[model samples]
Target: MAKDSSFDIVSKVDMPEVTNAIQQAQRELEQRFDFKNSKSSIDLESDKIILVSDDDFKLSNVVDILESKLVKRGVSLRALDYGKVQPASGNTVKQEVKLVQGIAQDKSKLVIKAIKDSKIKVTASIQGDEIRVSGKNKDDLQAVIALLRKEDFGIELQFINFR
Candidate 1:
């Protein structure tokens, strides 16, 4: 009898990489002439990033710097869920951006449903924050991968632990 192959589908962020990117952006903000005295700052909370600036233009500049640093560190922009900018005191504005790491409960269900709808001979189970898809044939697995890649989940995903 032949054994079935499997892979884990996940959306995970490397914390160290994210920290490095934040630090790099901070350094740039400090050294850049325009932002040096602009009183702009970036803060990373548990699940979100807060950007505060003296004005809208400064806020945009700060966001651009952060995005560039994230890209340099191999973090996809799609993983960043940006929120609305709110006005603060003294002509300042604040923006909160959430980082999507693991798949949420609703998304997990969607993934399973999609896999089942594909009519492939496979088993998909939601394991904690990730989805595990297993099948007897590698071709079916490849097709699943292709289907997943075509879906817009608003977060970056990676297939790992293929066996």
Candidate 2:
């Protein structure tokens, strides 16, 4: 008998990197002239980020700055599921950016479908927010990974736990 080669596909974000990006964005918000009087602010909660600004224009600018900081910190923009800007108390606008940490059921189905459709000699199974792919040949596993990379799943996927 031979051991199966396998890898897990997961959508994970490094919280420390997110924290650093938020801190950098906050510093820029405090120092930037445009944001000085705009009263723009960013707050990171357990699984979401809160952005507050005086208006929609400033709110978008705040998001852009945060996104740039996040990119600099190697955080993919796809990890963020942004909410619509809504009016808050005192006429301020607030937007909630939710952090996506796992593969949803629909996405998992897509992954499985893609792998099966590709006719690759591999098996993919969903393992609670992650996909486990295994094959007798390591080359087949690598091909599956490459095939998945070429598809746009609307989220940042990471391949890990290879064995």
Q: Please name the candidate that would achieve the greatest lDDT relative to the true structure.
A: 2
List, residue by residue over 1-163, the lDDT tens digit for candidate 1. 9899999999988878788899899999999999866878898998889999999899999999999999999998888999999997767899999988899889889888989998999999999999999999999999999999998876688999999
The sequence of per-residue lDDT tens digits that candidate 2 reaches over residues 59-79 is: 989999999999999999999
Best by TM-score: 2
User: Candidate 2: where is the Cα deviation over 4 Å?
Assistant: none
Error of 1 at 131 (Å): 0.7
Between which residue pairs do clashes occur in model 1? Answer: none
Query: Model 1 segments beyond 4 Å from truth?
Result: 89-91
Query: What TM-score against the true fold does each predicted structure earn?
Result: 0.89, 0.98
Q: Rate the local accuracy (lDDT) of all candidates.
A: 0.91, 0.95
Candidate 1: Cα lDDT at 92: 84
